[model samples]
Target: MLLELQQIIVHPGQQMLLKDISWQQLENILEEMGERRAARISYSNGWLEIMVPLAEHEKDKEIVGDLVKILLAILDVDFEPFGSTTLKNERMRQAVEPDTSFYIQNQGAVIGKNRIDLNIDPPPDLAIEIDITSRTRFDNYAILGIPELWRYQKQGLEIFLLQDGQYVKSPFSPNFPNIPIVELVNEYVPQCLTIGRSQAMRNFRSWMQENLQ
Candidate 1:
């Protein structure tokens, strides 16, 4: 959604400079909730957009793929790392695109393209956001019913676990507490800008081996 401010000039002798600001909010509401939905939101100065994946996004998809491949090589799991998508709120009439998202093995049940028709439902299990700007209000995760969220900002990582319909900072995760996400992110993210994907994967593998032992 885009919002704009307008200025109108009337006559020459009778000068009239009328200043008017206009804002628009766009919402995509569904009648029945589907597997997922992706949408964008606009704010003044900056916007908070989320792309709910019918499938994974580009770089994020690649990252999740690598992580899953590495994890499967080391651990015994029958699942694969699903892609990220966007989500929306019909009741509140808001939309946001999470930076990165995923559905763990067997979590999706079914998958399709086009768009996930979410009438009203809880969001994905994990939503990742790269915080380029400080949120004027608390992050919009809770409003969308996302169970857990990982936010990266200022070279620091914060994990928020949803409890009692609200988000609370917790080191313990009900879903993948044993995964040590913080350590993995800390080690891998820095290398993202400097190294190749293969090298990063090798380093992650090495780190996992040491940690597992």
Candidate 2:
């Protein structure tokens, strides 16, 4: 078999950008790339960004994702977690694979489903990105109309809520309006690095319990 020129190598903590990529071309690339790939993607208009996450990026993604899950579980909210699932809309000319995503308010919409078609199905309620590599781009998520987005970078978290068609930085997540999510990220995520993940999670749960009570 001959080698395909389509192969490209993206290093961790780095990103590659391509221009004038058509929607059909993007679809073909996605199909060829398969779903289990480690690289995350963000496409808007005719621009595509391919980002390869570093190991630290994955660690941060997992920890932040765990934090979100814990928050939902403690709040007794029904949610479905979609980790790095490709979300594409041909009409909108946008495709995004977030580090982690959740269907909270729209959890029932995707219950017991293996595949998600963004054209027919509702988008995830909240999407989280761990930008340890600082290579994440938000245009696609905003265009895809994800209601809430949490961006964690360098041990800090920022919540962006979709009010109209754009994302607005907000201190509180609509899903967890009463909790101090930013502070939670600043506090426990670092604790995870120091005390280890399991202990950090335990402390976070206890802290939430004390605060929420």
Candidate 3:
């Protein structure tokens, strides 16, 4: 049975904490929460947390996600985006749904697979988390061994890379090692909100073609 379930209201949304939950229980919760895109659920070491993402949180998520995709396309890189897909490792007792995830170098590994088993399959190459309402637990992702993580909070983007079994603050993304990760996100994300996504993407593509050449 689920234990120590409590709800905390945070002005715009709610977060529920459940303690002493088993890995099986966390899997059950995910099954029950299927297709509920707004819910952010994380479980680690017998603890479970559920959060309803705030509107502003989603706005930043979209902006960042779009910017990343634009970068991949303009650079002619192969990638598969899995937006907010639940990633779980039963043996590790850890699970999380990133705001946006991508299979970059390992895209072919997950192709045509209906279900991913972390035991064998490689985890997403990059994961994006937007922290506006509630902060994500970086420790959990570290345990999951996701190669790179991008976190957007307080109008600033932070990049972290997995190194020596831990996440270290990174100045450049492993995905785009030569480019400026935080600067690109900061400049284009807000511009998308101002000029509309379509126009912003078009302009960005044109600029990238010229600059990247």
Candidate 4:
């Protein structure tokens, strides 16, 4: 059992890449590791990468996640938020644990699902990734077939929409069809830093209701 342990640390609170690891092996590793705050595992083509997020990474992740929630609330949209839930597809040879994920258009499909099987269940309508340190490949998410992905890095956000078996950088989110996600994140994330998350969220929601309504 000791010999089977093939872990190597590339950087503290960053990434650990392993080669020739099977899906079941990766599952075993995650199970043995148990629950960890802000830890993410990804697999593609027999290569597995484990990520341990840092403090700044989590701060940005929370800010982006909060903003999305506020926007949903403002629009009176029906959504179910799943934070850092492990998503995988053995057939696709892909897996990921997003910083935050949501079911909006597909909300009813998974309302009572205790275990999600991507082969049958629809993937998250939207997934958010905060890339302060470790970068997630768009190709991996593309393979997973998530409809929308929001990636934040260097205070900039990029929105990717899955189309025709590939990801395209889109100006707007498919989930929030009317909103410009990049502009929204840039404008409001800083306000959270200045006025605090709760206050900023409150103010943004009020503004949205007044303007959007």
Candidate 5:
């Protein structure tokens, strides 16, 4: 026989208070439980939300890393990868944690912790989101000042490139025109777990080496 679990209702802003409990109190509770992954926290307007990854959620991170590796090997661009860092707009008093982000070398840039101080500068060159569920707003990139944003869903990949301070649908990437978004998503993401990271990377390299003419 199957058993049903009860659901608990939580108010929108109450979750953040959990973090305020003493670290020692939390540690004691955690000691009796299985290992838990760290949570990524952010404040949306005035609501606090925390993102906790499942133990088996490594596939998304692996796929993103593989994409970065493939891009670096195929293109001669310089970039650095950051995962889930807090980006803030002080003027707007908003903070966001992008799933994956990158910075191009020699660009006017500033970095922050818990919140990035944008001052008057624009966002990063690229931001990637792996969407398991629908988001409340699709215009997060615009609000964050991101120039390029890619969202990967089970249906396919959506590419939004910012132009003239607005987002537009484009067939070619403004940052890397030669790399096709759809093809990459179709080819690499589905095969991430089956082939394993090293072998998958080797296969990707071989494919790119053959096609990058």
Candidate 6:
């Protein structure tokens, strides 16, 4: 504990890993950091990583999240969005704060609840992470039993479905099997920068309506 938590500085697009951090220490650190901070964290066993996302990272996350909301609305699917909520399990000694998470099939389970306890409540049906700043740890999500995860990096979007206790890369998301999400995001997300977020979303909506049928 020589290096106090306040002394640790994680620059944008950079991350720091601390070793041998106990579960209680992690809890204390999380409490100290507070809920509104910009940094995100992941813990596995005794290892903890604190990451500060870059500006592009935030932009990417927003655009993709908007697109997801549009999809859910059009499909008339009931869902609840949890943005960067802390999901942790003390028994598993694993924790992650995703860019966004959604309760789709299990939406009713978390309604009106202020907190989500993985020990009792079901894991999010879909988890989204923008990997521009730091790579996601699949082990944490897999161990948590999240059914699906979307990872968007510089290359493009990737959809992974939990199958047989592991994430298998797939071209389509289980929730939107008829649509090609990877292609849609890659083509539309950049439009947020060029034409503005609102216009980009409108265009995406028009495209969805015209093409979905």
TM-score (all chains, Cα) for each model: 0.61, 0.92, 0.91, 0.91, 0.70, 0.96
Candidate 3 vs candidate 5: the TM-score winner is: 3
lDDT of 1: 0.50
Better by TM-score, candidate 4 or 2: 2
Off by over 4 Å in 2: 1-6
Ranking by lDDT: 6, 2, 3, 4, 5, 1
* Candidate 5: clashing residue pairs, number: 0
Question: 87 in model 2: Cα distance from truth in Å?
Answer: 1.3
Model 2, TM vs. native:
0.92
As for candidate 5, its clashing pairs are: none
lDDT of 5: 0.58
Give the lDDT of residue 195 in candidate 6. 94
Any idea how many clashes model 6 has?
0
- How does each model score on lDDT? 0.50, 0.85, 0.83, 0.81, 0.58, 0.91
Q: Assess candidate 2 and give its lDDT.
A: 0.85
Deviating ranges (above 4 Å) for candidate 3: 1-12
| TM-score of candidate 6 versus the correct structure, residues matched by position | 0.96
Task: For candidate 4, give the lDDT of residue 65.
Answer: 90
> What does candidate 1's lDDT look like per residue over 1-213, in tens digits?
542212322221121211221222232212222334332232221233322222223354356446645765676544323344445555544445555554544344424433433454335566666553323123456666677777665465678887776788877545565887776776686675479677888888888888875
Each model's backbone clash number = 16, 0, 0, 0, 0, 0
Model 3 misses residue 87 by how many Å?
0.7
C-alpha RMSD values across all candidates: 9.8, 2.1, 2.7, 2.1, 8.0, 1.3
**Mind giving the per-residue lDDT tens digits that candidate 4 earns over 7-73?**
6444546687889998888879878767654468888889988888888788988888988888888
- Candidate 1 TM-score versus the reference: 0.61
Which candidate number has the best lDDT? 6
Worst 10 residues of 5 by lDDT: 4-13
**TM-score computed on alpha carbons, candidate 3:** 0.91
